[model samples]
Target chain A: MQGAITIEGVDKRYISRGRETVALDSVSLNIQPGELVSFVGPSGCGKSTLMNMIAGIVPMTNGRIIHNGKKVSGINRDVGYMTQADSVLPWRTVEKNVALPLEYRGVRTQERKQRVDEMLKLVELEGFNKSFPRELSGGMRKRVALAQMLAYSPNTLLLDEPFGALDAQLKMVMQQQLLNIWREQKKTIVLVTHDLSEAIAVSNRVVVLSGRPGRIKHIENIDIPHPRDVFKVRFLPEFERAYDSLWEQLSSEITKGESL
Target chain B: MQVDESAAVGTGLNTGGSSKAVLAYEAGLEQRKMMVRVSQVLFAIVFLSFWQWASGRIIDPFFVSSPLAVGGRLYEWTLNGQLWSHLSVTMLATAFGFFIGAGIGFALGLLFGKFAFLAEVMDPFITALYSIPKLALAPLFIIWFGIGIESKIAVSASIVFFVVFLNTFAGVRDVSQIYIHSTQIMGASNWAVLRTVVIPSATAWVITGLKVSVPYALVGTVIGEFMSSNRGIGYIIAQATGLFDTNSVFAGIVILMVVGAIINGLLKKTEGWLLRWKE
Candidate 1:
């Protein structure tokens, strides 16, 4: 109930050198608290723009977003945003990276350490506390980034292609871990990804957007039961049906995007 | 099961053979190192011998002093405590100028880096000051600081400031935007971002600037001493030139060389410690 998000007539435009480009059209959506929703679309569909708008990093040309009962203005610090790039600070050890947000919040040293250790364990990176980001493998570093975002226990999460760079096997493992965490934490999660199957596997509802000036084209409610295994969920008939419908909707947008 | 056991045995033997190959490679490396050392010693001995032989025979001893004579002069200076006094004076000037210049440069670099408008406004002025040959200011420095160690320090500091400031400024500007953005999203204040992200990120550049300016600091100090100072290795060299004592001049040059090498070694150690994460 605390992490519910409301978007109404949200529009985003970028103006450079007196030329204006529309990134997102008038879009509206309501995300209930503790719901897992995925935004799947072609490249340049402004999926990331929608994510940034919710996080309040990018200002909307018109319209507004509401997180919980509060209006989204400036940086929405109540939500943790994990960017697509490797966002872990290379200089800091894994433990230090996870503790960064806590430090910013002025958490006491004792509690910060305890929380960092707990978060690292949650991400299954218990023994890598002292290791630098450079020393960890790509997937391990991603875990550190995940732990860092979850360190402060923000009620909402905006993950922008968090596992896009990972190999297929590693990506599935991370998805499984994310699902487990989401189930346990019961936080509102908005995932923007290009992977169609990943959307059906992790999200309770899949929102497909049209290309360039992104607008919500279709929303499918995944009928799969809770605690679905990411590996096995794809084989389910319901999962396949959702994927087929979403892919059909998404592929047309990709072709339109290329032509434009 | 039999196939698996044989494959394991094969891997074990391969590991042993590879380790032996590694040992042989290490031995080869040691031998090469020894060869380099021997060759270096031989080159030094031969070069010194030729210089000593040529000083009186091929060229006048007045112009090119014999190595033995230079060595004797160094010994005499050391015995009379003149070497230590002059060496200390030069070292003090270099250290003072270096620290002052590096400190001011680092501070200004951070300040300008944080305030882009200030950096842009001051760009032309900084460039003008930097372009003026620092050594050419030695006479003015001597007049202002009055031929004391202060003048030498001023000369050294002025030269070192520019080198460090430019590097630090570039380092600050080159900081990754993603890092800053992520830190901000984590609720870091501007000061917190600078302290935790900007400063640490720019450390490699700062260290490089410091390392590069060490020689420049020494150059400024020696040039300052050459212009006006009554003491220092540069003074010894200037006085020897006036008296036509090429031996003392050569001795002074050798002392500066050794000092430079020692300072470089110390700087390398500091750089290693400061940037251990890089390794």
Candidate 2:
């Protein structure tokens, strides 16, 4: 019950320039505790919007989100959200950025340093502790971002295309690293991504959503065994079958979205 | 640029002076630095010599004021300690005005940035006030604040206010929504987010505004002094102009240039130290 998230009949409506825009409508989903679920959809699919609502960064217009049996309102401190863009503070060093959540929770300096050091080692950024974010490469910065998100040990993570900016090889490595961490911690994860293969490779369940006013179109269970080698997962027959089915559902929605 | 393999290898070595190549590279660099200094001195000498030679032949020495005459005036002012007193007075006015103006500007900028309705309501008035040539209001400031350092301070403060305010406002407004949302989701309260994220993010812009407004601050002080003042470099220049002492006028101008350059250099150093993380 620690990481269960129940999004019930959530709708998001935005009024911009006197025009009402329905971003998400009747989007209900139940995520089991410690489940790794990926939301795959086209652009403007309200995937990120749903993630924001679940994190309580944005409000749900019509319904509610419950996490761990408690209703989530403004600024859900129970979950950590890794944004698509680089959220690493340019002014802060890697250690400082990772230590931010701990500092917010009033963790003592000595304990904070220990945890930050451990997190840095986990992310393979141990030597770059004092280096500022601006001095880091894109992949290194992504690692720093991951370390920051995972530092305080949040029970749930909402990742929005976290590795979208990374190159193919680095993305695979990061995906593997993420899987390693998720397997160990068993934290509930909700990832919103445009890449269908990525969704299939990492998540236990891939939720495909339709275009604007986004609603769940299909949910596919990826029954691939644990300890997935993200680098070689595509070679597996089950992986191929899941990819084909998920691609079929996602591509049709994408085409429908395009025609509109 | 040629890739000097020996120099590159020399740079890679952690051992001190084990390689002859590093010594050669160091020597080359030293020579280049020396050459640059020599060129700079040579350029100054040529320019000053030309000015001295052309003073009487090409232009009227009385109007132009030869370099020697300007130097003589500078020495006389320095010997009498008038230069130090005037420079110190101007610096004090500039410093006080800059701090007060920048502080208020930064505070209001944050307030207006957070509240869109307030910014919108006062947008036109702020724009109108900023649009007026600040020097044009010097007479009015002189009247209101009297003919002392206070008038100069008022003038300099007005000049600095808009620059810092506009930059700080833009900096706050331009903070990415993603950063705010991410920080909020990470359990930072509104005040915490403002303190840790918003203010730090706007520091670069605020520093830039301060750097750009430095000359304007100086302008305000000098203009106020020119209009009416008892102790400032601008007062010296005004007095010299009234007496038609062109050499003293040039000398005052030289001191102003030196002061401006020194202030700019100090600002550059501060900016480097503050923004070293950027590198």
Candidate 3:
């Protein structure tokens, strides 16, 4: 029950220079505890906006989001949020960066060290504790970020294209790592991504959103069982069918968005 | 060929050629460094000799004092304790002004950087104030603080304030939004976020500002002394010029050059230690 989230009629609007723009309109969704859901849509879709709302970083213009039966007002600390950009503090070494959330929670030094070590091992970056972010390669930095996010063991994770910047080979490796973590931890995850195959490969359900003033267009149940090989999952018949159906829904929305 | 073979063997693998290449590259770098040092020493010798040779023949020695006369004057001052008294006074003024100015500027920068409304409201006024040539205010500072060390401190502090203030402001304002959001999501309080993310991130800019402002602080001090002072190096120069003692004037200028170089070296050391993470 700790990871369950209910978003009711969430709307986001931005008024700038006296021009009102609707970013998301009456978008509603329910994510059960331990559910892995992927949100996919065109470029302008409110996919990231919805994720931000769930994390309570961005305030909704109207409606509400409930996590664990409590209304999320601001900065929901129960969830970990990983943005597209690498958010590892450049000034901190890998160990210190991973220790940040634990430090914020007032965890003692010894426990923080233990947790940080565990996270580094989880992300396969066990030997990189003393290295600064600038010293690490792109994929390694991402691993550091992942380690940092997992350090505090948040019940839920809101990832907005966390692997978007990675090359294809690294992306698959990361996806495999993510799936393995998901299986072990069973934390509720809401991933916002543009990659259709990524959406279908890892999630229990893939939510397709329409462009601009986004609304849910179609929800596809990915019946492909887990312990999924992210590299080979696409070869499954069910995976193919789901990808084709979701692409059909998503492409039309993208074309309509471009015309506008 | 023998050295290369030995180096390759020492490296213990297929990287033998690369190890030899590295050794050659390092030797070349060392050779270059030695060449640069030798050239620098030769250049200084030639330039000083030319200046000494040409002082009486090409230009009047009175107008362009010879290096020997300046050195003699410095030796006399050092023996008589005049150098220590004047140098100490100037150093004290510079130190006090640098600390006070940098402290206030850093504080105000954090204040304005955190509050966008306050910064926006004060932007035009701050810009207008900053536009005024700071040296032009030395006379005003002298009048307010009198012709003592206080005025010199005031002048130097005023000059340093703007530089530190602007750099600190930009540093704080430019902290990455993602960093702030990441900490916030981790349940960091506003105070925690500022301490952890804002301050540490802005340290590079703040240190750069401090480094840049050191010379400005000294300039302000000397200018203040020039406008009105009885004791610092600037006063020595002013007094020597009034007496038409070109040797003493050049001596004071040489002392200042040495002082500036020493201070700059110290600052570089501090900067290296403070920003070691940049490597």
- The DockQ figures for the candidates are 0.39, 0.41, 0.38
Tell me which residue pairs clash in candidate 2: none
Q: Candidate 1 falls in which docking quality class? A: acceptable
For A203-245, candidate 1 gives per-residue lDDT tens digits of: 9999999888889999999999999899999999999899888
Each prediction's Cα lDDT score? 0.90, 0.88, 0.90
lDDT tens per residue, model 2, B1-279:
012222333322234544888789989999999999999999999999999999999999889899999999889889999889999999999888888888889999888988999999999999999999989999999999999999999999998999999999999998887788877777788887898788888888989999988887888999999999998999999999999989988998999899889889999999998787775
Cα-based lDDT at residue B270, candidate 3: 89
Candidate 2, residue B7: lDDT: 31
**What TM-score, computed on C-alpha atoms, does each candidate reach?**
0.92, 0.91, 0.93
Q: For model 2, how big is the iRMS in angstroms?
A: 6.9
**A1-260 per-residue lDDT for model 2 (tens digits):** 99999989988999999999999989888999989999998899999889888888788889999998999888888898898989998888889999988888789999999999999889887667777876667777888889989988899999999999977877888899989999999999999888888999999999988888799999999999898999789898998999999989889888988998
- Can you write out model 1's per-residue Cα lDDT over B79-198, one digit (the tens) per residue? 999999999999999999999999999999999998999999999999999999999999998889898899999999999999999999999999998888788888889998998899
* lDDT of candidate 3 over B1-279, digit per residue (tens): 223322433321234356777889999999999999999999989998999999999999999899999989999999999999999999999999999999999999999999999999999999999999999999999989999999999988998999999999999999999899889999799998988899988999999999999999999999899889999999999999999999999999999999999999999998887676786
Docking class of 3: acceptable
- lDDT per residue as tens, model 3, A129-205: 88777766677788888888888889899999999988888798899999999999989999999999999999999
Candidate RMSDs in order = 4.3, 4.2, 4.6
